[model samples]
Structures are given as C-alpha cells and as structure tokens.
Target: MYTLILISTMTNLSEIRALVLPYYEDVALICAIITALPVLVGIILYLSKNHISKPSTPKDAEALVEYKKYFTEKELEKLEVPYVQRIENNIERDVIEEAADFLKSSEQVLIICGESGIGKTKLAIEISIKINESKELTGNFKFKGNCLFANLRHYKNPKDIEEKLNAKLSEKTVLIFDDYQYNMEVFNEIKNKALRRNSKLIITTRPIFVKALKEKIGEVSIRKIKLGRMDINGILKDLEDGDLKKVERISEGNPAIALLALDYIREDPDRNAKEVFQGIRTSKDFFDKIIKDFQKEYGEDFIEFLAEGELTGGVANIPQEYEKTMIEMEKSGHIAKHESKYHLTPDVLSEYLINREFFSGTILKHSFEELARADNGTYILEMLNSIMKIKDDREIYRKAAAKLLEIVDQLEPNAEQKKKRIKTGIMVYDGFGSLNLVTEKLKEFWTDYDILQDGKDLLDLGIFLIKISKPYEARKCLEKAEEIFSKNHDKVGISSTSHSLGIIYQQQGNYEEAVKKYNQSLEMKEELGDKSGIAITLYQLGNIHYSQGNYEEAVKKYNQSLEMNKKPGDKSGIAKTLHQLGMIHHDKGNYEEAVKKYNQSLEIKEELGDKSGIAITLHQLGNIHYSQGNYEEAVKKYNQSLKIKEELGDKSGIAKTLHQLDRIKKDMDRLKEKMGEENFEKAYQKIESNNK
Candidate 1:
C-alpha cells in the first residue's frame, strides 16, 4: 500500500510540473508588462500636457462686456467704492477670505446666504474680484481662468442659462450666480460638469433658497457662507457725523440700504440727511418680489398670517393645521422660530408687509383699538409714518390719520387697556402730524372719560404736548394731571406733571412760574431717589435762570445738571445743559468760549440724530457769527439751521431763522449807509478774501 501511495504522489508531482513548465515564457512576459505599465502612463500624461490646446483667455475689454451683461451701469459704477469687509464672529473668519479659500479647495459650489439688501451680491462680486486677481487662490495652477457672473433671472429660460454655463465654464473657472434659485435638472447637470472640469460655482441668494439648493445639488461638495447685516459703523464710514447717524437709523445695518442712502445724498446734495432718508424709497421691487414669491409658495393666507404676526410684536400663534407649513416657512427663512413662537424675519420685510396690508385695507379691517392692544402698537405708528412719506398719498394718509384718532375714543379705559389707549393716542398724534385731529380727539376723550382719575395718562399727554410745542394745551393737561396726582397722593405722577409744567412755562417766557414748577418737581424727584428725573429738573431750572438773564445762576444750575447727567451717562441731558451754557457765554460776549460749548453740544446732538436740538445749536452758532459781524458765515450757518428746521416742519424754528436772516440784511444795509457803495463793496471783498 505504501509503495502504491508513493508512486501516485510522484505521478501527481510530475503532472503539476508538466502543466506549469509550458507557461513559464508567458509568466515572464506578464512580469515585464507589469513593470513597464507606470512608465507608459507617465509618458502618455506628459505628451497630453504638451499637445492639448489651452483655453483662450478673453481680453480685459471682452471681460468687461461679459460683466456688463450681468451688472447694470449703475451697479458697475457702485464697484468704484471699495467693498467693506464683513467678518463672521463664530468662525473668526473674513467672509471674503473664506470664500476665496473655498474657491481654492475641492469644493465645487459655495452658496452665500443672506436677507434681501444684506450685501450678498456685493460680497460675491468682491470675492470674484479677489479670485480673478490672485493666482495663489488657485494653488498656482497652470489653468488660469476668468471669473464670470450671471443673474439666473436675466436669462429667458433655465435652458438658456444652462447652455451659457456649459459653453463658458472650464477648468479653474469661477462662475457666480446672483439671486440663484434651484432648478433640479439645470443645477444637477451644471454641478456634475463643474466637478468633472474642476471648476467652481458661487451662488448668492436669499436664505430662503439655500435649503432647496442644497437638496437639489445632492452629494456635490458644497459649502455655505451666510451673511448678516453689515456693522452699523461700517456702512458709509466717511459720511458727515450727523448724516452717519441718520443712515445708521434708516439702514438698520443693511449695507445695500446704506448705499442707497448714499446715492440719495449724492443726488440731492443740499437736502438735510433726514429729509433725504425720508424720501428714499427702499427698493419696492425687491420687497414686492419677495412677498410675491412667498405668497406663491405658501399661499396668500399663510403670508398674511406671517405679516399679521409681525405687526403684532413678531409672535405668530400657529394652529395645528399650519404647524408643518410654519416649520417649512421657518426653514425657507420667511420666518424665525424662538421659544416655540414664529416671527417674520428681516424687519424691513415686516415693514413692507404692513404697508401692503394698509393699502389693501386688510389692516383697516381690524379695529384700531384691537391693533393698538396687540403686543406692539408701534407698528401702527410706523406704518402711518411710512405712508406719510409718499407725496401722492397725503390725502389718504390724512384720512387714515383721522380714522385712527376716531378709534382712540372707542378704546375702553380698564387698567391694562388704559395705558394702551394713552400710548396709542400719543403715538397717533406724534406720528401723523395732524394737530386738529389730535385736538378734537383730546377734547372728546377729556369729556367722555374722567381725566381727573387717570393722572398718569394726563401726565403722559402733557409731556407729548410739550414735545410737539403746544404750550397752551400742555399747560392745561399738566395742571389737570397735577391736581389729580395731588388728590391721589401719587408723588411720581406729581413729579412728572410738575416737570412737564415747568417746560411749558419756560417755553412761554414765564420764568417765575417755570422756576416754581421745576423746584416742586426737583423736591419730589429727590424724595423718590430719581437721579435721572433730578438731572432733568436741574436742566429745566437752568433754562429758567438763563431766560431771567441770571447768567451766573444759570451756569451753576447747568454745571450741577451736567455733573448729574455724566454719572448716569445721559448724553441727551448733557447736550441740553451744554447748549444752555453756550447761550449764557454768547450773551456775555465770550465768543470763543461760546463756540466751543456749542460745538460740543452740536456733536452730541448730531450723534443722537436730534434734529430739533441740532437746529437750535446751529441757530446759536449763527448768532455768534452775527455778533462777530461775519455776515457771510452767519448767513451760511443760519441757512443750514433753516434747512433742517424746514425738513423737520418746525414752523416756529423756521420763523426764527428767517427773522435772523432779515436782521442780517438790515445790518448789511446799515453798513452800506455808514460806508459809501464803493467802500462797502471793497469791505465785502476784503471779508470774502479773509474768509477764503
């Protein structure tokens, strides 16, 4: 058996050798082929690099032509202004820098998300300019390419855009799509092509569109850089200090709006910044397009609900049926959710919606009382102010203003609701600029309700009356409020009412009564430990002393008020005190000291956007120039003050300035009489030369 097994094993071994020996030549050949394969690939790659034709770069003129197709002449002009860099706090990264980094990476797509007018397109343009200039941004790759821009809406159809993109895009090329919306077929095709060609795409769109874009471009290497509103100080940094404050208030950190404001100023160089801002129609088309798109996607009722929510202090109460819709709206960036409540996003949108509702009469369908009782009544006032800006809508605004006041009489005066009624009435009068309507409403309210019972309401109305320069009406309200407060033993109400009365008396030139009211208010404020109230009373007392021609006493009171104001950082109070001090110095013939004080006050008022205060200070400066016989300088300052007063509709202030101008003319005539015509002409020339 062992012999047979050995013989079989040997036979098997012999068969295996016989099978392997014939293929030895073939095995050697396979090994040689494997060893040379890498060398063959290297040779092929080198030959391909040298032989293939490179993409032709367009000349600068041709590039400009292509860019013009995407940007308007006006938009191109805007590029002359350097782009302000925006930084992201969370990542501590410059948005432009991050975008450049993304362009250099393997990421094929970058979506820049922001609200309308938040500078997304401008940022994208800046990023494109950066990438086009810097070869380092492309890792110093040999395939230098152009940066192209297109707004998707500019094309007649998606197919047109797709064809253009396919024809233009190449390796290392950067393409920007401004105001991009997702089209699944077009985007998917372009995305695949971009990946294959090693190109990059940058998309600028409202935040609402980003989610849809992400979903449509599935598995594509994409990054997102969200933009927020520009910093308040960053927008138009070189604007005059007063104009800067106006722009900051009106733009609300929106860089596009800020730029629009700058354009308005350029167009009307002589207008007050406040007037220019009031007349600037924020891109109605942009806001209208957003609303239309939202309505189309979410239905009219849903859009209305969001708008109404915004009008009512930004808290939307979603029902069970609208829960999914609300979530989708939040995802689409039409609304934001906080603590289980949804709010319409981008306050400008809310303002637009309110305006739309006002025009459609949808807002008027709700009683003014009901609207006023909503979480924020200020929206109603803001809406009225917006309407008042439209020159053609004056009649309609007056009608609406009347209707608002009429509704105030209907409001019930329960504890919680009474406060709303008083606030609504004051806001309506303050914002609408209709004194007759307010006066009628006040008379009706006083007759219908027991004014003596609501001391706080009377006090509030009196203060608002004083602000509007209605001294007679303010005196009536304050006296009534003081009587009620005394009867009720409400020291805070008494103090506020006394302070308000002091303001009215001082305005009326009744210095003795003004001092008495101020003392009463000051004593009560001290007892109540109201530091801010005491500062205000001291300032008022200083005004009384100044009017009485007691400069020394006025300075003492003003210094006391100034010290108190500084401790609490009450800039407005400090500014008022400084202005009074300047007036005293001016009367004492201390021109230099007076100018210094007035300028300090003016700076603070400009920073605060206090047009009324600014006008007053400017008028005082004009007085100093007049006293110094600098006729040209005085007229310049007076006209500057007059322009602001006119813009503010301060009739009394305007009258005062016009009177000063008349006095300046008379003074010039008197000089002409004292000095003969030729001598007067020579003197005027000399003054002009000195001024130069």
Candidate 2:
C-alpha cells in the first residue's frame, strides 16, 4: 500500500512540473525582448546621426582613410579653440561652403576680401582644410603657397610664383596667394597658366585693393567673399566667460585686433575699454615693425618713399629712384598694387601714416611751397575743398585756414595761387562761422592788393559782408559792383548785386527801396531765365510782405519760391518755404494747418540733419500746442527744441525756448488756480488723448 502511494505522488509532481515549464519560457522571452529593444533603437539612432554605413568595396574604405588624412590629429585639435572653432552668424560657414562648392565646380580664382585684422587668412586656411577633407573630393589634394611676408618678397613676379606652384598643383592643387597685390602682369600670367581648370588660386586682400583685380579679370567668372564685422563675432563665442563683449567693442569688428586686445586685457585687468581702444587705434607697432624690418633690409629712403608714395596717389607717379623699393614693398605686403596704382595694406595704417605726415608739417610745408611755386592753385584749392566737403571741425578748419593764409602770404602778389588762396580762406571762414575773420583777411588783402577793382570780386565780397551784418560796408562794394556790371553790360552780375543790395535795404527797414531793388533784380533774373535767382528774389519779397502784414502776398510769393526750389531739388529751400508758410498760418490762427506745415518742414530738416532748422520748427510746433491749451505737450516740445538749440550752441534759440517754458509754467500755475489740480490733469488727459 505505501509503495503504491509514493508512485502516485511522484506521478502528480511530474505532471505539475510539465504544466509550469511552458509559462516560465514565455516570461523569459518577454524579459529578453524588453532589454533588447532600447539597444536596437539606440544603434539605429547613432547610425542615423553619424550617417554610418558599412563599406561595400575596398575603394570606399580607402576614400574614408584619405579624407581623414586631410586634417592631422594636431590640426583637428587646434580647431577646438574658440578662435578656430567659433563661427559667429554662420557668415564664415556660408563663405567656406560657397568657396568649397566653387572649387569643386572648377572655379579658378576665389578672392577673399576684408579690412585688415578681419580674419581673411584664417578663413582661407579654414576653406583650404575643409576642401581637402571633403568626401566628394577626388584628386591628390595639395594646398601650398608662401603667404608669409618674408616669402612673398622672394616672388618678384607671377612667373616666380608659378614656377614654385607648378609642382604642388600637379594633382588638383590650390595655390594660396594670401594678401596678394595683383598687377596686370601677375594676374594675366596666372589667369592663363596656373589658374587652369585643374588648379585653383585663392587670394586674400583688403577691400580697397580689389578694384584692380575686378578691372583686369572682369566680373564674369570671379568669386569673391567679403569678411565683415558680423563674421568676426566668432571671437565672441571663444571668449568663453571672459570680457568677450568688452574686447569686441574695443576691436571695432576686427578679429585679429580683438585677439590682440584680449591678450592685452588679460595681462592687466585694470585696463578700461577706452584705454584698450585708444591703444589699438594709436598702436603703430604693426606697421612700425614691418617698416623697421624693411628699413634693415632696404634703407631709410625706401621707407620714406613708402610713406610718401601712399600719401600722394601711388607707385606710378613716384620718383624713379624708388621703383625697386616700390616693388619690394608690394612684395613685402606693406603695399598692394591695384588699378595701376599702389595702396598701403590695411587702409587704417595708411590713414595713420597720413595723419603722422600731416602733423609733422614736413610734407605739408613742401606741398605748400610747391603750390606757391607752381601757382597752379588746383591742388591747394582741392585740399581746401575737401575740408569743406567733409565739414571738418572748427579747430581743423581754423588751422587749415591759417596755414593757407601763410602760404598765400608767401606767394607772389599777383599769383593765381594767392587769388585761389583768398577765395578758399573766405569759404572756410564762412563755414566756420567766423565771417568777421574773413572780412578782416579780405580787407587786409584789399588794402595791399588791387583786386577790389574787379566787379565780380567786389560783388562776392559785398554779398559776404551783407551776410555777416555789415550792410553799410556792403553798400560801397555793391555800388562799385553795379558800376562795373553796368560798364560791362553783365546783366547776370547786375541782378546778383541788385539782389544783395535789396537784402541790405530790407534788413535796414527801408521797405520801399528794398521792394524796388528786388523787383529790378527779379526782372533781370526773369529775362536771363535764372530760376535760382528768381526764387531768391521772390523769397525776399515774401519776407518783406510778411513783415508789412501782407499775408496773402507773402503766401503767393512763398508758393512761387516753393515751385522753383522743387524743380532744383533744393531741400533746404523747400524747408524754408514750408517754415514760412507755417508761420503765416500760425499768425492767421489756423493751428491745424500751421501744425501740418511745421511738421512737414521738420521732416525735411531732420532728413537733411539741419539741426538749426529742426529746432526752429520744433519751437513753432510748441507754439501751436501752447495756443491749443496743451500746456504739458507744449513744455515737451519746448524742451525738445531747447535741447537741440543747446547742442547747436544757438544762444538765441535757447533764450527763446527758455522764455516759452517760463511763460508755459506761469500759464500752468494760473490754469491750476482756475480749474484746480484735478481739473487741470483731466484737461491735459483730453489733450494728450487727442491725436494731433
């Protein structure tokens, strides 16, 4: 019985094990699938990101190995630095990609241009390296050129460069002419031979010197990349946690300069932004070093020619004595050849050299002496004309005027240069707002010289004298001018002199005399078809009429003046007319019309940067607001007018604005008492809410 029970229990245990075995297998399979799913997904993602694929052929493996060879491990490491790695705004990246694509598409010449210290060289190196490493590339790629200034001097001509480049460009080579000064000879030789379909030439240079290449090669097939301030922001990224912005602000969009400035700031944390910028601007170290090196190799005279050559045009007109020096300097990267001329590298260096020469007075004195001797007058006149063109500071104009006067004093009494010199001096003094000095200088010359007998000269002097409020003295000169004009039958001269006399009479309150002279001038101007002169006479007549309360006549005259000025695109004349029209409307109590006219005048004046005119219009606008019971708005406009007046040093305008402000304050106090503080605010709220 016990044997039978043990056999039965064994049978039951064996059946239980058989039933659970299948379920155990299912649980293990499910666990294994859950564990493998993440690993499979991760592998797929990695492959997708890296574009990894198994090589199907031996050539594929070889190509991969070759692509990796373009950048050595050491070079790859260098790119990790922010200076190399950081690319701001993708400007450099887009350029690099465009260049690479061009090179691949068989574009022969790629010119990269920018101001110096703007990272042209680095960008070029980056481009070359990227091209070499491209997977699509096919050839024994070689990027070889002597971009060093020292090495560049050895290349006397394009033939010398081509000879050296010939071997490297055997299998799709890139010849890098870093900061190349392309002359017609060099460009022609390379364009024919080295710049073939199989090989490419990459040139880096400043923007100022690229005109020559463009002129020679024609803009058809040339590919150009301009590195700009936006590109230099790459340095900002590499700046990491330091004062990158400070360095960038100091650099003024120059990468190399920013790097130098960063190093400078790191050396002494105490240095401020102003000091750093000043140091960068004032530092002649870059050019000084180059000059010193050249001086040692060549001589002091060679450097002097380099200095003078840059100042006065270029190497073409330089004395034959410095021909070899010019060539050497061009090779040495101190100067670049463009447009059949030689310009200094890094334009700012040229500016610094010019300023240095100007202050030294040697070159300036020599030029002055030459002008005095030649009596050609054009050069000196051009120099003075440039001062006016640029609208230089009063101090600069004063100094220039003084120097020109000294030159004039040294010139021959009846020399043409002396005449031009006086004319230039008067122009400069007039611009400087020192017309009294002009009067003094002209009077001094007139007392000593016999130039006043000339009708045109007397008329010019008379008009200028009247402008400076010397109407009494101007009358004598005008009478003389009229006499000469009458004898010569110069209708144009008579009209101009008569108009000037009318101005004097009008200012002296002789309304009838002024009207008669103006009408006479207008008749002659009409006969001569001088639209400009007619417009001037009409404006004067308008002013006289307005002063005498003839509003309708004034409006008509101003409208005619406006039409004449519009034909000539005389923005200032249009603004003046609009301003006068606004004044007339204001006097007539047409506040809305007056405001529109004043605003139109203000827009034109602001566009022209006519600060004085802007202030006047703002003042008028303030008056309109004050009349409209908008005291707060009036104060705001008055303040704006006053601020501009202070900036312009217009004492009269300032006084007027201040008086308006005082009157507005008193009006506000009275209004406050009459309406109470709350009521006054409510009234201001309504005015403010009104869109005028």
Candidate 3:
C-alpha cells in the first residue's frame, strides 16, 4: 500500500510541473525583452543623430563647398609663431587649457576680455587651436567640429553678421567673434540658433564691453577668461638689454605693442624703444581717438580731472558732483574703483593724459595752491618726472622746471613744506634744470627759514637726495642734520644721520668711509638699545663687506643682523638677511647652501605676503638650479619667479628673469643639437613625466 501511494504522489507532482513550466518560461522572456529594450532604443537614437544624410542637390553641394572654404579660411591654421603661453594665476594651468575646459563643458559662450593690445584676439585663436586639436577636452561632450573665426569689426551691420554666421552655425562647428562690439540684437539671434543647433561660440572683446555683453546675454550659459601680461622673454631674446628695458617699460605686457616697438626699432636702429614708442603714429592716432571720445562724452573738465588723477599715480579724489561720471567710467573699464577713489585703467594711459594736458597748458592753468592742496603737491612733481622721462626736448624740460620752481617758491616755510620744495628743486636740477640756478635759488630760499630748527627735516631731505643719487648733496644735508641733532641732543636723529651718511658713502663705492660711518651709527644704536636700528646698520655693513668681496666678514655681519632681527621678530629684516646670506653662498658656488638659505627666506616671505621678496628668492632658486644643470627644474623655478614679478609690476625683475629664461632656451637648444633631436625629445619627455 505505501509503494502505491508514492507512485501516485510522483505522478501528480510531474503534472503540476508541466503546467507551471510554460508560464515561467513566458515570464523570463518578458524580463529579457524589458532589459534589452532601452539599450536598443539608445543605439537607434545615436545612429539617427550621427548618421543624418547630407544635401544631394548640386546647389546644396556648392553652397556646402563655399561654406567649407570660408570656414577653412576662418580657422586658425596654427598658433602664431613664437607663441608664449599665458597663465592666469600662479597655477601652471594656462588660459588655453581653461578655455578648452569651458568648451567641453555646457558653457555655450566663452568671452576673452582684457585691455586693448593685451592679446585677447591671440588668446581666442589659441583656444580655437586647442579645441580643434581636442587635446585638453576630457568630458562627456567632446568637440568634433571645425573652428571658425570672424572679426565683428569687419562686419558693419548686424544683419550682415547674421547672414554670414547663419551658414556657419551647426552642431559640428564653433564660431569665434573677434573684437565683438556687444551688439545685443545680433548676438541674441545667433545665440538662439546656436543653442538649438548645440554649437558653441567664443567672443574676444575689450573689458569695456564685457558688462554690456553679459547684460545682453541674460541667462545664457557663458564663461569669461581674462588675459593678462605674459612673459615675453622668449620673444624678446633678440633685443639688446637697453632696448629690452625700454620695451618692458612701454609695452607693460602688451605683446602687440612690444612687437610694434620692435618693428620701429628695426626701422630706425638709432632710435630706442622709448623714443620709438613715443613717436609711434599708430599710438598717437589711438590716443587721439580716445581723447576725442572722452572729450565728447564727458567734456574737457573731466579729461583735465583725469589727467590730474593720472599724475597722482592713477588715483583721483572724485567730488560728489562727478560721482556718477566716475561710476560710468568704472563700468566702461576706463577706470577702477578702490575705496572711494578711482584709478585709471591700463596705467599707460596716464602717460598720454599727462602729456596731453602738459602740452595743452591745461596743467599749467591750475593755481599753485590748488595743485599743492592735491596730495601735498605730489601731482605736480609726478607730472614733471613723467614729462622728463617721455620728452627729450630740453625746452620742454626747462618749461616744466620753471613751473616747478614757481610752485616751490609759493610753498610756505613750514618744515615739511620746505623739505618738499627743496626736494623738488633738487629733482629739477638733477633731471634737466641748471644746477647752479637751482642751488643758488635753494640757498637763497633756505636763508629765509632756519634749517637748524628741525634736524628731522634736514635728515629726511638727506635721505631723499641719497635716493635720487646725489650723494654729495645728501652728505651736506646729513652733516648739517648731524650738527643740529647734536646741538639738540637728539641721539636717535644723530644715529639716523650717521646711518644715512654710511649709505651715501657705500653707494659711492667708498667702503672705508661707509664702514667708519656705519661703526659710528652702530655704536650709537647699541648704546640706545635700538635693536632694529642695530640690525639695519649691521645689514648695511654686511652689504658693504659683500661689495668689497669680504665674504667671511659679510657672513659674520649678516649672521649678527639675522640674530638681532629674530630677537625683535622683524620678519622682513630676517628675510632680507637670509636672502643676503643666500647671495653670498651663490657667489661662492655653494649652490646647496644657497638653496637652503633661499628656501628659508622664501618661507618667511610667503608668510609675510612679501611678493617682491618671494620673486627674488624664486629667481635665486632658479639660478641655483641652472648652475646645477637641472634645466627643467630651473625653468619651473624661473616661471614661478616670473609670475610673481609680473604681478608685482617689477619690470626690471621680469626682464632679469626673462633674460635667464632666454639663456636657458639657448642652452637647451645647444643640448638638443648635441644630443640629437630624438634623444633630446626622449630625455625631455622623461624629465617631464618624472616631474608630473
């Protein structure tokens, strides 16, 4: 009976399995189809999107051919010869890399903005090349298209831009509008079409147009890259040192102007870069246009005020009545606002404005009192210095000197005012005026005021004269100051005058006299327990020792100064002492020691926000690397140094760093020739990879 029951159960189970098996199979089939359906649909969509048919008609083909030709012409075939990569910050990332990333992202428009002649157009072209090469793009949306460029300045009417751009707008293309005029209506039309077609656009424009462009674009996806001055050391390798300095001064990082200056130099080899730049017809025309526009927009009064502001180191104290005008100027990128003051843009424009006002006699029209009231007469002095630097005409200098002398004569006999007048008189004589005339007038003028009354005034005047390279004049002032201070029993004043005399003698290459004076100051500082003053005197003594090639003596003095500075927590003094020690080591060919010292100094400078010091240290580090034949490392250090120097507007430092870079380039070229191209390339790649 049990066997029969088992057999019956097995048969019933088998029947139940047969019934469920078919349904299970159907469910599995449905699951498979559901899983595969989305993928199949994606494939279909991709194929359809990518494999659209082209126009087959003859007219369409011809039109397509014409468009291709136009685009080919518009495309930047390659970067300009001797292109210098421009970095926006201390980071190694360049503008081209940043712009390429923007293109790869969802941003539909990239605007390159900067001052005129700051290479905005060149930057745009570089970005175009980067996009075409597809080198930096690593994103979901990759650009695979023709890069086309157009200068909007060539297109007079908005309608014409619309018509020309219509043929170029597509998913597989990018259009760059160079020198965009911020035509909102035309941009809107093009942008709307570009959005629908999924194309990107780039605009190169002056910073003045950026605000209008943004306001016009509204909510459209956009990005902006601002170009600044780049290291043109490589480009200027052929220039003489004098010419290089002249170009650095005038170009102010504008490569186009630098090149133009170079061309002028080539044309008239006798004329220097400054002379060529001053006489450039194009620059004159450009300034003429700017002056005319400014006069038309804001009137002659505004221009005069701007000239005054320019004279005062680009700062202008805006009155309430002209506040609105200043706001407009700031928005237009003609000026920058800083704490209730407006600074003129491009700084170079200051030269033009001052020259214009001076030649027009607009500057002379102001009362001496009015001029003196402005920044304690700094504007008048700055105007004179600027005119002296730009103009070679002795007649112009004489006229300016006469005006300065007149202003000096009107100043009150107050100690501070008298010092200023005397300084101005000395500056006039030093620059262009007759020394005897200025001296006799100063002598007569000083007789009216008792110089012995204020030792501080005479001391200050002595220091000022020292700075202006009039060591003899400075010595006389210092001697008188010392006498007055001794009579008044002013120990601090006497010590300072002694130190000033040391600096004067030191600068004149009289190490023995400098040492004697420095010893006198040092003794007084030690007696008064003036730790900072002692450190400073010791540092000056170290400099004297260094100049005289007394390495051991210099090191001893520097170490003593360093210890004193540390005790006082004078970070600046400490950094400077460390830097001096590093220089000694560098001169001694102790590169390792030099680097260590520089690094120590660099740490403090970085902490203190001492950009100038940091630049100096970085350059020193580059020198060490160069001496050690670490060319790649040397270049990295140099670039780091150059970036800081450029930011600080240390034109001389920039030129020096560039000179080093040029040297490195020449060295590398020689190496390449010696090692053969293939071997050099392999070695360079190895070094680069290792650095990465």
Instruction: Return whichever of 1 and 2 wins on lDDT.
Output: 1
lDDT tens digits, residues 269-378, model 1? 67875565545432453335455555555677766666666545565567777788876656534566666666655433434444355445442355444665454344
CA error at residue 568 for candidate 3, angstroms: 14
Model 3 has a clash total of: 0
> Clashing residue pairs, candidate 1?
none
lDDT of each: 0.62, 0.61, 0.64
In model 1, where do residues sit more than 4 Å from their true spots?
Answer: 1-302, 312-316, 320-351, 354-357, 360-425, 432-452, 465-476, 504-516, 567-569, 647-649, 674-692
Ranking by TM-score: 1, 2, 3
For each candidate, how many residue pairs have backbone atoms clashing (under 3 Å)? 0, 0, 0
Best by TM-score: 1
TM-score, per-candidate, Cα-based: 0.52, 0.48, 0.43
Error of 3 at 135 (Å): 3.5
Writing each residue's lDDT as its tens digit, candidate 3 over 431-486 gives 54244446544653433234435688678667766755667767887898899899
